[model samples]
Target: MTYGKFAYVYDELMKDVPYDKWVDLVMKNTQKYNIQGKRLLDIACGTGELSIKFAKKGYHVTGVDLSEDMLMVAHSKAADNGMDIQFYQQNMAELEGLGQFDIIGIFCDSLNYLQSEQEVLDTFMHVYEHLDDKGLFIFDVHSIHKILQIFMNQTFTLNDEEISYIWNSYQGEFPNSVEHDLSFFVLDHKSGMYDRYDELHFQRTYPIEIYETWLREAGFEVVEVAADFESVSPQTQSERIIFICRKK
Candidate 1:
């Protein structure tokens, strides 16, 4: 589950991801819900993209990720930007040591990487333990339609003079899960050759009801469940589901 070489190339490949939308979601809900604290925790905050963005928005941001390589990149970026974000290498399910936060977010579909229901529930409970009273816990996951209909058995290719990639998706062992097999080729200018790297990653998601129930079971009150950053209930073909909850 290590990103290995993928850590360095992640930002370039994910340049089109809606990072601003996630930050907007937090600000919108914080204002709407009257959350005033500036302390924020970014779970699975790969390479600290959202963490740095949150910091820029005046949040006292702390980032946690399982991959040290990703955290290394994040730390360097934060230092370069003169940001004081605290980056920690830790698994979200077993997250500890860091104190409570006013807002805890698991962005970029990182929650989907959990392999089992127990781990998901454990993560929810741990997040509850680390949130201040009435703090917000926001996360998003890939909708089932996206996993089965849009991604399953799909092959995607990216071609560039400097970098190229071939990505394939297949059904995973767990229900509502998909495995991504990626091969990346980066051109070495000096050698006039390509250095190839391969990675396999698994992601799973469940019915929205299941996530809501888990949040409540972990002492949270469901504030909103929206699809694709819109404040509307999810429809049949929604690609992403977002959840916003408040610690009770």
Candidate 2:
């Protein structure tokens, strides 16, 4: 999806997301692993939230996302924050032109949007190419168990004075996948009416073994597998799985 109108309201809807937690994870891992450089590439960095946070922490941050509208919003946000971050409109699976980075991240389960194994592998290969030798690559995904147990066949609703939404998730055609159907209502102040917008988003994830194998095939050394922001191995019921890898 292009994110069109959703780009405008994305931050408002995601206000509760723990962006600082992601930054802390990166910093903690960097210190633990003795990573020295500060150059960072944030893939699928929606609206520059995490990117800005990273920049604030002294990293030279660059962000990439597929949606032009999202990039537009990201650019405006960076400008308003007096940050000099570079925002690129590019597909993560086909990354190019940008120089290498000491750390590359695809946080917030953004990798789930890749529809095929080939796309995931391609993204890994490109990320490997764009990383400095021995550089860290950190990412997270919605665990298969969570997709099946929590999202599939689920309906969620949020009601607020300014904005509200009804979200439904259904099993996708692919294994360990789910399709989200979202309808949003936003109050229009001057018109005294509510504007409705509908969006469909698809996400898929593979088993942990599959991800490890693909990363190895792309010349990366799988370092750690953490669950739900904890520095521990994933459990059967972990909703989010984090992978830490290093380019070899």
Candidate 3:
């Protein structure tokens, strides 16, 4: 998936996303697990949105992503905000060189982008390798219910003065996967015209049990599993599954 232009409009389209809920989740879980260190590694940290948030909260943040374009946007945002954050271009599955951190996050269901079970397992092992002995691994993913019941074969649209997009979701070749074909229109003030672009995004998710097993194989002890930012158990239709784990 190319994020050349999507990187620029991501934050604008995701303005309604409850980023702070992630912040609160991290803080509450870290405190609950008795982790007091501030260093954090944000994997697949697109545009550094949550990385910057963690930095503002006094965490020593390092952000990693697969897209150089996304890292560029993140770097610009960090510099503009006067926040000191380290941004790197690296795929989450092949993450390396970055040392252990007090906390590691793969938020925004970014893991769903991994195309294979081995990639997901590799990511879990890498996260285990790069986590402090007492650190926490916090991440979330689209639940099976959400992928099948909510996103499958859906068409979504947004029309605005500055930007607009038509998103079509259909079944992917892989099981429990969704492919999103998007066409975007952006108004240009310089010439009073609209620039059109297209991008395809692929996302797939597995059952929570599959993820739990991978976590164990990667030498992690599952601490908790939550749903939709709630502290209770995941219901039949919960859209998101959050995993809390520590180094085994």
| Candidate-wise lDDT, in order | 0.94, 0.95, 0.93
Residue by residue across 6-86, what tens digits does model 3's lDDT show?
A: 998889989999999999999999899999899999998899899999999989999999988899999999999999999
lDDT for each residue of candidate 1 in 109-140, tens digit (9 for 90 to 100): 99999999999999999999999999999999
Stretches off by above 4 angstroms in model 2 are none
What are the models' TM-scores?
A: 0.99, 0.99, 0.99
Superposed by TM-score, candidate 1 places the C-alpha of residue 200 at a distance from the truth, in angstroms, of: 0.3
The Cα error of candidate 3 at residue 109, in Å, is 0.5
Clashing pairs in 1: none
Task: Give candidate 3 regions above 4 Å deviation.
Answer: none
Pairs with steric clashes in candidate 3? none
| Model 1 regions more than 4 Å off | none
